[model samples]
Target chain A: MDKNMVTNARELTNTEFFYGHKACAGCGGSLAVRLALKVLGQNSFVSLPPNCMSAVGFLFPQISFVTNAIIAPFAANAAVLSGIEAGAKALGLKDHHVVGFAGDGGTADIGIQALSGAIDRGDRIIYICYDNEAYMNTGIQQSGLTPYGARTTTSPAGKNLPGSIKMKKNMFEIVAAHGISYAATASIGYPEDYLKKVSKAAQCESTSYIHVMAPCCTGWGFPGERTIEIAKEAVDCGLWFLAEYENEKFTLNRKPSSFSPVKEYLMKQGRFRHLGDDDISIIERHRDHKWEKMLKNWDS
Target chain B: MDRPKVVKYKEPERAEDYPVGATFKAGHLVQTNSGWRTFRPIIDQDKCIKCLRCFLVCPDGAIDKSGESLEIDYDFCKGCGVCAHECKVGAIRMVKEGADEDGR
Candidate 1:
C-alpha cells in the first residue's frame, strides 16, 4: 500500500495491492509486492502466477489486488506480461506498466525458462523475483532458489547434510547474460535503492529484471516484524548484495560498511536453529566467495 | 543460439499535443492494457463509528477525515488494507479496485 512515507497526496490511492488475504503477520512477499506496485502506480498491470502471491490474492471474489491485476499460471508470469504489454499497445494505452511478480521458486527454478525467454525477447516489462529462500507456499519445501545449508522441509537438518547442499542460483548474472537493457538486485532493507531501480526500469523501453531478497519470517522462524531486520542482516553479512547493471555495466549500489558475522544472522532464525560451527563455516565461505566476486566486478 | 532481430530506433514525431490521450507513430507501440490490480478500502458508513483507526495507522497518507466521513484515495492506495484491519468496528472493507473498468 502506498508506503511512501513522504507523500500525502490522496486521490483513489490503493494502500494495499492485495489485502484481505492470508499471510503471516510479517510477510515480506506481501510487503515487497505492495511496495513494488506502489512504485509502478495505477497504470501498471501485475501478472502473478501460482504461488503464495496467487494463492493469497486470486482466491475468487476475495482478490487482494486493488488495481488492474491479471492472474496467470505459476510459470506464465513473464509470457503473460509480454502479452499484456502487447495488448496495451494495441489498445492505444500509454503510461501503462507491466510487472511479472514471481517467487524465487518460480523464478530461479520452475518459471526460469519462461522468465529467460521474456528477457531474451527484450519485452518491455519489469519482473521482480521475491526471493524468500524456500518455497514457503507449498509446505516450505526446498527449491533451487533455497540457499546452501538452509533448512527446508525437503532438506531437513541432519548430521551429514544440515540443509540444502547447493548454493543459491546466481540469477542476476543469468538475467544479465540475456543482454537485457536493465537488471538489478535489491533487498527490502534498501527502500530508496529499490524504488529508484523500479522507477528507472519503468522509464526504460526494454525488459528489466529485478531480484528482491525478501526475508520470510514464517519460513525463517523469526518474528513477523523482524522480516525487515533479517533483510538488513542478509545485506550486512554480505550474503546478499544490491547492485544494478545498465547496458552490461555493473554498479554496486550498497556495499557493506563492515561485514557482519553470518553466524549471528543465522542464529536469530529458526530455520538455521540446527546450524553449528561446521555449517556456519560453510555459510561463511559461501558468503566470502560471493563478496569477492562482487568486489571484483565493482573494481573492474 | 539465434540472435533475435533487434528493431532499429527511430525518432518519434510530436503529435498535436492533446490534454491527455494515447498516441502512436510508425514503428512505435503503446502499452495500453495493464493486467495489474490497485486496491482501495471502502468504509461501511453504517458500521463506521468514526473510530479513526484507519487514519492513524495508514502507512501511506491515503486516509483522511472528510467531515464525519473518512476519505480514502483508491488511486494511491496500495491495497495493503491496514486501515481495514485497524478499524475497530468492522467498518472498512477492501474494495476490488479503484477508478472504473474503462481505464479512465
Candidate 2:
C-alpha cells in the first residue's frame, strides 16, 4: 500500500552511529539503528542487549558510538533503560531520552517481561524492536518472533513441521494491551511512515513501543539489493501491516484498497521456499482473519 | 613456517597494475573513493586447523582457501564476524585498525 514513500540514501542522517563498523551487505538491522538514532539524536542513550548490534560496533575504548551507549545483558535492555530513566530523573536530567533497541529474540522472548513492566510502570522511554523474524545473532535460531513456515537453524525445513510451526507472536497487540501511550507496527520498506512513527514516538509524553520489521539479507537467503523491495512487498501483500494504536483507537496508516496475494511476499525469500499449497492456504486464511479484525475497528 | 602465502591479483596472461610482494599488512587501512577502508579478521595459521568453518560461515564469499590456508578478500568482506564466531579452533581473530587485542 506504500506508494513512492522510500527515502533516497542522500536524505538520511549522516551520523556515524555504526560508522567503520561491520555489518553484512544490505543488513536491515544496521539501517534500522542508523535511521532510528538519527531521529532520536545525541541526547539519547541506547540500551542494547547482546544481539547482532553488540557485535556490530567496536568494543570498549575503541567504540563506534557518537552518543552514549550501554550494553545490557541479553534480555535486560528494558530493565536497564528503566534504571537509566530513573537515574536521569534523579539527577534532574529527565530530558535524556532512553532508547531500548532489542532484536526479535530479545524482545518477543527473552526481554518481553522487562518491557511489559517498564510500560506498565509508565517509564518515559521509547522501545524499538528490530524484528528480523529469527534469532540471527545466535546463528539463525528460531525465536518466538519467527514466522510460521520460515526456515531457521532450529526450525529447518524437513519431514516433520518443515519450518517454524508456530505463527509469530502478535507483539504489537501484546504491547498495546499493556495500555501504553503509543504502539505501532512499522517496516523499513516504508521510510516516510517509519520515520513519521519514529518522530511521533520521540515526542510522545508516555511510554512508546515501535516494532519494526527489518529484513535480514544473509539469514533470509536473499540478494543484498532486495532488502528494501521485500520490505515494501510485505506491506503490499498485507502480511505485515503499517498501523498505529493510541488510547484504544486503531488507525491503519496505509490501508490497501486491494492487496496482493501473500505468496508474492513469501516467495521472495529462501526461508519460505519450502512452503506448499496447503501451507500457503493456511497463511492466507490467517492473514485474512487478522486483516478483517483490524479493519473492523477502522471500518466505521 | 608457511610465510603467510603471497598472492598477486594478476590477469591470466597480463601484468596487473598492482605491485607484486607488496604484502597486505595486518593493520593497514586505506580510504577509497567511497569511504575509508581498513583491514579486519587476521588469521593465525598456526592456530588454523583447516576446518573450513570460516569459508562456510562467511556472510559474503570474501573467504577463499586453497585447502591449506585461508585468504580473505577485503573488497567484498564487510568484516562482519560470522566467520570468527563459527571458528571453533580460534584461528581467526578480529584485529581492528591499530589495536592490540591480538594476545588478549
TM-score for each predicted model, relative to the true structure: 0.73, 0.72
Once fitted onto the true fold, the runs of candidate 1 whose alpha carbons sit more than 4 angstroms away are A1-15, B1-104
lDDT of 2 by residue, A83-147 (tens): 99888888898556789889998999999999999999888889999999998877899999888
The DockQ of each candidate is 0.03, 0.03
**Fnat of candidate 1, please?**
0.00
Q: Tell me the spans in candidate 2 whose CA falls farther than 4 Å from its real position.
A: A1-12, B1-104
In candidate 1, the second chain superimposes onto the true chain B with a TM-score of: 0.54
Score candidate 2 by TM-score against the native. 0.72
For candidate 1, give the lDDT of residue B41: 66
How high is the lDDT of residue A249 in model 2? 76
Cα distance off (Å), candidate 1, residue A248: 1.1
Worst window of 10 by summed lDDT in candidate 2 chain A: A1-10
